[model samples]
Every structure is written in structure tokens, then in C-alpha cells.
Target: MNKVIKIENGTKQGVLNFLEHLITTDKISGVLTLRKINEKGICDYGFISDAKELKFADPFAPVMPINAAQTLSSLTPTTKPIAAIIKPCELRGFVERVKRVQGSMKNVLLISYTCGGVLPLNTFQGDGSEKIIADYYNAISKGETPGSIRPTCKACEYFVPMMADITIPLLGNSESESECSLIMNSEFAIQISKEFQCEIITSELDSKIIDKVLAVRISEKEKLYNKTKVTKDGLDELVNIFGKCVGCHGCSRVCPICYCVMCDFESHNFDYNIEIFETELEQKGALRLPPDTVFFQIGRLAHMSFSCVGCGQCEDVCPANIPVATIFKKVGEATAGLFDYIPGKDLEEAIPVMIFKEEEFEEIGK
Candidate 1:
């Protein structure tokens, strides 16, 4: 059964009040949410222990510098319980990592809100003030989509969280409304509700609003997919897509799924002798300075696309502007679809490549 908890004020102040209540009431040890790094508007995850620090908390910030999953994975199996405010994509990425044993959900409370997407870091010019965040939230609550949101976010299919302990619904709520609705999805959420003395009432999700948004997003995703589709299955096409790669490996570094401590690309095998480079130069008449650009990209696709959550961090950090996220999302969708698998949907489901059945993929074998 679903229960609704009314926030006395709007969501901005209501959330801050709730967080303070959680800390003062000894419900959580700390809070993990976004805070400004400096006077600039740049925001990153921070662990707050003092209620006074809630002034810096901007859980609804319209920017994602790095996926919070990586940060959450690093802090998991923690000594004490903590509350984490994360975006839907970040939560999904964390779910995938947890299944891989890279993260733990033992003592963490996952709280999420309706995401209105985010803008690129370069475009952000605010000072991470509460008013700025509140204004943006109010605008989004009024059904206005900002023009500065990222392309990937505009076409995102998973803007609303599904597996969170608590969810704050920003859609279908009028800006004039004094209270915000909280969706309790877990027993932990119910406990929190009781502790806060929030009224528990039966309520249904606004499925029509969600469906309308998803339909537009799906259409946009198809358009982007077609535009980026490879016409031929050949090395030449891949080269065109990845030819400008400088081999900085920034994409792998930011990827939550590329968890290998030592990647094959950085292994001793790629450390060739000068004579080998001379031989390649003689044979091909020309050689790219650092070879295996195609190999590295294809290797990553094979290794991580099965669990790719399409956070776009890979493309965000790419120096060459290779549209890495687009390619990865396209490939990831196709590869995962073949097995009827949705990464992060179920923790018990095994990774496709790690398990096999005689009946599976029989057509391919034949």
C-alpha cells in the first residue's frame, strides 16, 4: 500500500526541515547530498554531520559533475547509517554496482526526487544558492522544461526513481500548493514517516503524467538512435566514430562499470618496443601516435555495455567529443535487450555473460 506524507511547506524547505529532523532525532548519522565546492556554482557530493550545514544542501541542483554511484560505492559498508540523496540515473548505476559487489546497501537510505534533467557544468553560473534551486524547482513544478538541460537528460527514459526507499514527487504538484507529497516505498521510509509524525494516507501515483513524459522521451531517443546508427558493420565505420580519440582514457575513469584496477589498454602488452613502432610505420606508411583506439573502445563496449546505465559521464569527460555516451547507450540497449535484461532492474538476476544455458542463444549457435 502507498502512503502520502505531506511536507508542511514547499519541497525545498520541507526537505531541509526533514533532513534536520532526521539528524536531530538520531534517525541517521549523516546526510550525503550535493554541496558547493567553492564560491562557484560547481556542486559535488558532501557528507554533512551538522544541521547548520544543511544550508549548503542542494539536492535539486540541475547539474551532475560525476555519478554519485561511484561516491556511494566508496562509502558503503559504512560504520553507521547515512541518508543519500541521489538522482535516478545515479541510483540505477549504484544498483548495478551493488549487484557486482562494488557497492553495499547495508546501512544506507536511498532518497530520490523527480529529476528535471541537468545542464552541463560549463553552463552553470549560479552560486549554489537556495533561492536559485527553489526557483528552478518551482519552474519545473509548473511544467516548464528548461532550455539548458543536457541532450541525454532531455531524452532520458528513467527520470523517476523506482527502487528508492523514499521518493519526492515533483510532477503533478502545483507550485501554489503548500505541501509536497512523499512516496514511501520501503519499511524504512514508513519508519521515518512515523518518526516525523507525517500523516499516512492512501494515494496513487500519477501514471498519466509519467506516461506522457515517457512517450516524448522515447520518441526523442529513437531520433537520436537513428541519427547515430552505424550504416555498416565494419572497422572503417568504427574508425570514423573514434578516430579522434587521444587515448586519455577519461571515459573509463569516469565510468561506474569500468571497475578494473588495471585495464588491458594500460597493460605491459601495449608497451611495445621502439622497433615495433618503426616496423608499423614502415608497413602502414603512417601510424597514429598511440595505437589501439578502436580496440580500447570496442573492448569497453564488450566489457561494460551490459551494465551501462547511460549517465553520459563518459561523453562529458571526453576531450575529443566522441559522443561516447550515445554510442555506449545504443550498444548497451541492443546488447541488454537481446537477453531481455534491464540492468539494475533486479539485484538477483545474474549478469548475462557470467551465466549460460544450453537453450539460450541457440539460433546464434545454429
Candidate 2:
């Protein structure tokens, strides 16, 4: 049974009020949201272990707290479950990683809010001091949607949080400048509704409007796919996309799904002997200092193409501003498409790249 609860203004303040009501009555362990401090401060995104810590879920706060999903597996499972507030993309990314890292989800509840989009760290024109999401929100509240989003986010058409236990809508017939509709998608969600004192309404959602929003998203995604599709047919075009890589390797370090107990990336595995180093540069008139740049990315693609959630954290941490996420997302899309799979779409289905079976590839079985 689907139950809908309406809120006023959909402000951070109101969201917290409803959440606090649940917490006080022992409905959930905690609820996740933003905590604003005067329009400038690092927004902390973590589990609110206690209801008193509701200050972090501030409405006017600017910060993207996507790390909470990564935190869930680290904490012990609780009888008192938690309600997480996340945007569409972050929720999908974490759900995908939890399975790989063997993270715990014993008592965590999912709550996803609508996404307006975001500005990356570099191009984001702000105070430029300690780069935060609050500044970006301030811009967005004024109806200035960031001209550019992380390439992965821009291409994503699943703007709604499909994996969430509870779904909130900010688009179409449920539209309200100050309201976002909330609904429970499961039996547990129904039990939680007992915590609320208001009547749950049955509202009509327009299927036609849903199609329009999705159609626009698909058109935008195809444009991005064409724009980023560069072939290895020549070096010039490839160089234009990945030329300035300084071998910092920031992307893999921040990715949640790139888990390896013994990464060859570290522990001097790639370190060359004195004779080997001299011979490589000696053979070529000029060898790029990071000689295996293209190879390294391809290696990661081989390891992670199916699991790649395209969180854009690689682009976030890049110092040389290399288009790393764009390249990975493009490659991942093709690799995943060949198998007709979308990474993180199904929690029960194991990643095709990670598992092999004797009966697999049925087309060639005969």
C-alpha cells in the first residue's frame, strides 16, 4: 500500500520537524539532511545517531553529503533503523558499493529527496576558499541551476531515487514550490506511517507528465554521449581528453567500489628499477613521465566497468582537471550496454564483470 504525506514549504526546517516527530516517538534511529551555518561551512553528512543531533539536517545548508551510504556498512546493525536523506545519484552509487565491500544494511532505511543538480569544484565560481555545497545551494535557491553538472549527473535520466525505501517527488503533477510528496514503498514503510498523525492522501500522478520529463532527460543524455565519444582511432583526439594526467591517481583512491585488498597501484608495484626506467625513456625520444596513463585507466575499466557508478568523485578530486569521469562513464556505458546491464540497478544480481560461470555466454554455448 502506498501512503503519501505532505509537508509545508519543503524547507530544511520542515523536513527536520517531521523527522524529529518520528525520532521522539521511537519511529527511527535518525534522519539525514543538511545542517546550514550562516551560508558558509563544510556540511557534514553522517548518521544522526540521536534525535538531538538534528541540527545537521538544515534546509538552507549547502553541501553534498553522499558519504553516509559508505558509513552504513561500517556501523553496527541496530534495532532502531535510520532514515537517510540523499539525492538520486548518491543513493544509487552507495547501494552499488555496499554489495562489493560486504557492507551492512541490517537496519538502515533509505530516504531520497529530489535533486536540482550541482556545480563541480573547479568551475564553481564562489568564495573559492574551502569549496562547499552551501554556496551552490544559495545560487540554486535563486533559480540559477548550475549551467554545468558533473558529466555523469548530466547524463543520468533516473532523476528520481529508484532504490529508496521512501520516495519524494519534486516534479510534475505533484508540483509545489514549497512541497515535495513523500510515500512509503514497502511494508516497513507502512509501519513507519503509524508514527505520523496526519491523514495519508491518495493523489493522482500523471503518467503523461512522467513520460515528458523522462523524454527530455533521454534527449539530453544522447547529446552528452555524442559529445564525449572519442575513439582510440587517433592520438590527437584522445590526448585532448586525457593529455594532462600527472599520474596523481586521485580518482581510484576516492571511488567506493574500486575495492582491492592488495592494490597493485600502491606498494611500489609500478615502481621501476633504475635500468628499466632509463631503458624506457631511452627507447622513445620522449616518454611521458606517467608512461602508462592510458593503460592504467583501461586497467581500472577492466576491473570496474560494470561496477562503475560514475559518482564523478574522480573528476571531483582531479588536480589536472582531466576528463577522467567522462572517459570512464563513456567506457562503462558501452561495456555495460554490451551485456544489456546497468550498474547498481539490481542489488540481487551480481555484477557481470565480477562473476564468471561455465554456462555463461549462452550464445556461444552450442
- For lDDT, the strongest prediction is 1
For model 1, where is the 10-residue window of minimal lDDT?
125-134
Q: How much lDDT does candidate 2 score?
A: 0.63
Across 167-252, the per-residue lDDT of candidate 1 in tens digits comes to 88775457425876677888877776577866567785577777877887788788777777553467787888888899999999
Model 1 TM-score is 0.91
* Residue pairs in collision within model 2: 12-59, 34-56, 34-57, 34-58, 35-56, 35-58, 62-133, 62-134
Instruction: List lDDT for all candidates, in order.
Output: 0.80, 0.63
Candidate 2 stretches with Cα past 4 Å from truth are 8-11, 59-68, 76-79, 122-125, 128-148, 172-177, 203-206, 232-236, 357-366
Lowest lDDT block of 10, candidate 2? 59-68
Model 2 residue 289 CA deviation in Å: 1.6
What TM-score does each of the candidates earn? 0.91, 0.83
